[model samples]
Target: MKIITYLFLISFFTLVSCQGNAQKKPKSEQFEIQKTDAEWKNQLTAQQYYVLIKEGTEKPFSSELNKIKNPGTFICAACKHPLFKTKRKFESGTGWPSFDKPIDGGVFYSADNKLGYKRNEVLCAKCGGHLGHVFNDGPPETTGKRYCLNGVAMNFIPTKK
Candidate 1:
């Protein structure tokens, strides 16, 4: 009986270890590409070109949509792809634009930021364009996420009447 119980325990642990390994994803699978400076320049706008391509951040509260409380869709400034919906917008008080969730699979996350602060870096899933970082400290009742984005990296499309 003692030997049988030890074998059962080992088998259970092995199954759990295999399950964990199966769920682990490779780093390459997280992001699609690493674009060159010229490639990004050719794809983004002057403002987007500066922020996303150059890794620059826009001034807080400078975005026209920062105070906009109307229904709208936020698209990638580089590709104009729909990324976030008005419903996900929230006042995160982080000074930059914030979103609780992204529109479906519009964005992809990867390990980012080299400031010694670990954060999830968000990017335009379609074109892999840089958007910003996402933090866990956000409004409750939702995903508890704060997608702090650069205003220059996005363009707001107000909902049509």
Candidate 2:
């Protein structure tokens, strides 16, 4: 009887500790722009909705934004919140739009363990739209942080003369 009780206590503590590490997602209402699933689906194209709303990734090198070399700002497709500027963009050879940083308060991060390991998931601060992950592998001369993003999740607005 005592053995069984000890086992139960151990299990309970283990579960509680693990739950502490789980990420807590912010409620939709916390965002600057909130919308229902149907509303978001109606507003975004199929691909954009997939990456931005569903937290899905796009095929590497598939986005035309990857080839954009002009001066511009990348804004969230869901809310038009400014994210990355052309000056921060870099060629990471990873077939994604890589930036060393984002505009102030333009994005946020959450712990992502969907792959059975830990990763930092980036999201738009205004709309809570999933952008992509950030990594430490970036240009050393720069910020040394890679804000790898999905092109379908954003639209580039070229700077006007």
Candidate 3:
């Protein structure tokens, strides 16, 4: 019992240390708009940092943009890359802001399973900020895709026309 306990403690601390270092170190070349960890920390708000940098989800219906019905474009908060247009925006009733599709070359995809299930993770192509997940249960009459995004990860650019 003593040996098992000792081994468990050692492994736990080692794992924690490794994860801490990973969070601290920035993969500087991972994105086009590369920034030091300090720069990102300074630029993004606490909520934005959580969702964009740490790949966390904001609370459902917490964003006023979820109810926005204006004519505009949704852009990445981290890099200002235009993602979804007003034409693609829709109410998914999932609480988060949903879009039918992203603009051409505006975003990239990765496979994320941090929640024990495979999901298509969306990120800003310019800054590599985590946007949200993409699911297939969108309105079938259209493209049949739902880009469920974290509101803190994007900003709405209202159109002038």
Candidate 4:
């Protein structure tokens, strides 16, 4: 009887601790723009809704912006926070649009435990929208990092020079 009681208490505490870790999301105070689910749903397309709000990944090589080489800036689809510049873009050959880095403090990082592994998630600091994941596999010359982004999560604004 005592053994059974001890087992139940241990299991309860274990479950509670797991739940606490899962709910440990970044606070809204760190971000500038905050919106309810209804507001974001209305502002974004279905794909944008999935990638930005639901933290989903788009199909690889499916983004038209991946091939673009024009001088411009890519802004967050949700809040128009300028994230990456054309110069930072690179052909990672990973089928996703990759950038060496993001504009200074334009995005923030969060730990995503999806896909059965831990990964750093990049999000717009302004809107807290999921942009994509960052990887260490990138050109060794620059920042030695790759910002693997969902193109649908951003909008490119070409600069007229």
Candidate 5:
């Protein structure tokens, strides 16, 4: 009876330790850091350069994506990392583009913002590029989080028809 009880306690402790280690593991992949502004400019377009590097926002409703409906993957214009998908896109009627969710932890949240209103800012986790702001006001059936992204900051990779 004592042997059975001892074994149970030992197993429980082992399981807990393993779980803790798993939770502590880091998820991001390390990459060679690109360090110069000139290098980024050379790689991205003028609009993409402005938005992704300088943190500028494109004029609202000016993006071609305001009417885009095709299926595709949206990638970071600066780093070419996937950021959002067509299925997550939705109209928030706020002029700029909106999404229900990011491509699985692709974005990291931070305190925004140049505007007077304090808001939660979102950035690309990989390259630390600015994407947009996220708000809680969204369709009830969806994630209930509105990711208001700057279209210039992203490039749409259309799915093959």
Candidate 6:
């Protein structure tokens, strides 16, 4: 009984230690596109600045991009860098734009624990702008990843004929 108790304590501590070392947000200088707060504010709208620069979230269903159904690409609103293609989009009914995956290497992930729990935060690879969170609760038929994104963080460029 004593040996079993000791093993349980060891396992508990290991789990706690791992969880304590949460991933930190990348520094602004690490991104390809660097901008000061003033510049970002000048370029993006109030909502855009809130979501992309200040790591804020917009009201669900508030973004026009959430209803976009045309073929094209979604680019970072802050930098116009390609982030996700329309083909990867799915009607997640989450009120925000949802995608199975992002354009390869166009975005990066960081660990976020602001809610008293852990969540994988997504950001633009080019500008280090906050986009949203990704989760495993996606369509299993595809990548099985639900990249729940803030629609205000991106702009859709419809494909031209």
Give one digit per residue, the lDDT tens place, for model 4 in 22-64. 5657547778888888988999999999999888899999999
lDDT (Cα, tens digit) per residue for candidate 2, span 59-158: 9999899898899899999999999999999999999999999999999888887765789999999999999999999999989999999999999999
Mark the regions of model 5 whose C-alpha exceeds 4 Å error after superposition.
1-33
Model 5 Cα lDDT, one tens digit per residue, 66-150? 7777999888877778888989999999898899998996787766535534688777877767788998997779889999999
- Mark the regions of model 1 whose C-alpha exceeds 4 Å error after superposition: 1-36
Q: Give the C-alpha miss distance for residue 22 in model 3, angstroms.
A: 10
Kindly report the root-mean-square deviation of model 6 from the true structure over all alpha carbons.
Answer: 4.9
Per-prediction TM-score to the true structure, in the order listed: 0.73, 0.84, 0.82, 0.84, 0.74, 0.83
RMSD of 5: 13.1
Model 3 misses residue 81 by how many Å?
0.8
Model 4: lDDT of residue 146? 96
- TM-score winner between 1 and 2, please give it: 2
Candidate 6: the clashing residue pairs are: none
Candidate 6, overall lDDT?
0.89
lDDT of 5 at 59: 93
The digit string of per-residue lDDT tens for model 3 on 52-88 reads 9988899999998898888999999988999899889
**Which runs of model 2 end up more than 4 angstroms from their true locations?**
1-26
The segments of candidate 4 whose C-alpha lies over 4 angstroms from its true place after superposition are 1-21, 24-27
Q: Rate the local accuracy (lDDT) of all candidates.
A: 0.79, 0.91, 0.88, 0.90, 0.80, 0.89
Q: After superposing candidate 6, which stretches have Cα over 4 Å from the reference?
A: 1-26
lDDT of 6 by residue, 87-120 (tens): 8999898899999989988998888886658899
